[model samples]
Target: MSFSTNQARIRCTQLAPRIGDGPGNLAQIETELASAASDGIDLLVLPELATSGYSLTPSEARDAALPADSPVFARWQAILGEHTSAVIGFCEHGGEDPSGVLIYNSAVILTPGSAPTIYRKLHLWDTEKSIFTPGSDVPPVVDTPFGKLGTVICYDLEFPEMPRSLALRGADVIAVPTNWPYISRPENEHAPEVVHAMAAARASGVAIACCDRSGEERGTVWTEGTTVVGTDGWVTGEMAASGRYDAAVELAGDRRRISPRNDVFGDRRPEFYEL
Candidate 1:
């Protein structure tokens, strides 16, 4: 289905969730949701593992994991305005793994009057390999009042194919819930992760909103690189003093025309290239 509107107000809240504090983190998320709803945010993206925080031991992760059908989501849904939607990360308790109750790094899309849509992280990053079981299914493109919303976790955006597949599947916006450990770079350059996001947005002509965490966790400094990239591949929003990045972005339409003679999707010759 086509987007209900062409323009959407998106916000990425760079929150610093304390590790293993599920209740406290839930409170933090509730506050943000209420504020976003009051401010009429069309989409609010929160950092990866917003419910449980990062840098958890396996036992801690298990202790923090919540099932997809958790009642907390219903509470969050209650806080969302009719036109507002949110994508937040959590440690998911249930999985298809036969060995045991495996957890997955997952993001859930919560919209008013609708059931939650969860997307398990397909590509696990570094230590995540030891924590989460990789999702076998592809990411989902969900229908929302603002636009066609797609979701991916931290490391998923690093894979060019991930965003491209979403774009090809008719996603207008890709909401990324990430926790980027700080990596030193040139003084003036954007974090390498942000650079990857920019390139992905440009290549697919789709807006990307990456909500990265802030503050330090377990001695690991965060990039705090929350960013919003418009369809044209440039940074559209900057982190505000309150740690929120807000931007008004245009949603993708029926076509992906970049120039008079070229189209981002129509020009693709996938049959010729081995993915």
Candidate 2:
């Protein structure tokens, strides 16, 4: 399943995932997955918490979350019977761990005819902090036929280290499944998340597929950020203001060199910088 090299087809989707509507949400995701495959998309990235929805209290989140080995894996396996890959987000029933926190917002990475690899969110957003635990493990860099893929949940992208670490681990693309909220920025501009994404992409020199869910949830409006940044650290697709679907992206090269003398990753002087 090697990538197409100069051209890789990918998509980001945004949806209004209803709280407690697992069946309905799963159905909607299936429809989108089918459509993306039909539209020649090689990889489809879905929004974070796509299964159980966000904005849950601790008890509610626990009730809604599916265990890591839930039947949803079987459904996705059936979905990917032959071709295509997808990154689906969900609330995970992390169970009890005396040493640390349980209950995580997770991203399930699925390839054709294989078990899914789960990546929990490392940075828990506002209300999320109360309900979910931060992921302790580093996100896996999955080696597919197409590319080296990695996944991160919503707020993880805000940390520059997250994507940079993935890139350093040989990930060609980082899929971000996010549920962003509107914020008061310098000029009430478009999503500042986009700006951060651009910086992350450039700094890490990896393409990014950001899937942000939309529609107001409990009076909180989603920032509608469905985007794909190219390897050159530039926004390639439209970040729809009203939640639109489908963005085709081409991922090329493992390196980002500004010129013959300066390479983005090669020029890094991490040794001198004190963290």
Candidate 3:
């Protein structure tokens, strides 16, 4: 699953549909996909909870969830087949549980395949902890036209362990789909989300493609930046305000390859912390 030296270009969007606004969501997604397709992007990453706006109550969220074989999947599948490989977010159900239907903050990898492989969000946000079940399995780095890629949704980006784990398993790019809120208070002055992502990019030594939701959804104002951070911890591409997802980044395979002499993950000292 090695990446080629040839450059691979990726495009993404920071969608902002009104809370529980499904029609607007579909329209926006279709428009973005059409634009990305016209631009000839290899991969297109989108925001988390993209279909159903971020402020939905648990019940509203559940009701807005779509089936895996729904019409939306067919449309997106066609879009991917014609335009580009995409990572789309939607609430997914993983069969019935005694407690109730288990919902996951999931992202589906849409490519030319039997079907999209749904990767459930492992790290849950505060209220999200109560809404979705935490995933236990480690995601595998799948081979895409660009390179070996993997995903982590929203809060997963905050955990150092998440991207590190993916890098250790040999992922060239870590794609994150988020609904991050804008925090401008004095105590949390800096852009915490961007700072955290940069730190993760350096620690993991893999490129990070983070697409976040923008604009006002319900009452929550999100930090509307869709960014790309290279392995060197530099902001390669950014759309940091309430705007469209118009960032493109070229990742070099030669740059991502690690030297045999250097041990990045093998030397980690994890014994200090107990899970």
Give the lDDT of residue 110 in candidate 2: 84
Question: Can you give the lDDT of residue 74 in candidate 1?
Answer: 89
Worst 10 residues of 2 by lDDT: 239-248
TM-score for all models, in order of appearance: 0.95, 0.91, 0.85
CA error at residue 257 for candidate 2, angstroms: 2.4
Q: All candidates' lDDT scores?
A: 0.90, 0.80, 0.74
Model 3: what TM-score? 0.85
lDDT tens per residue, model 2, 113-220: 567889999888877878888888988888765788988887788888888989988888899999888776787554788787788888877888889888889888
Q: What does each candidate score in C-alpha RMSD? A: 2.6, 2.7, 3.7
Candidate 3 Cα deviation (angstroms), residue 13? 1.0
Clashes of each: 0, 4, 0
lDDT of 1 by residue, 1-275 (tens): 23346888999999999986788999999999999998888999999999999999988989999999999898899898687899999999985456777998999999777799999999988899898888888899998987788999989999999999998898889999999998999999999988988999888889999999999887999988899999888999667898888898876573378889999888988899897
- Candidate 2 total steric clashes: 4
Tens digit per residue, CA lDDT, model 3, 121-205: 8888888887787877776577776677889898888887888788878787888888888877566443677677788877767
- Identify the leading candidate in terms of lDDT: 1
Candidate 3: C-alpha RMSD to true structure equals 3.7
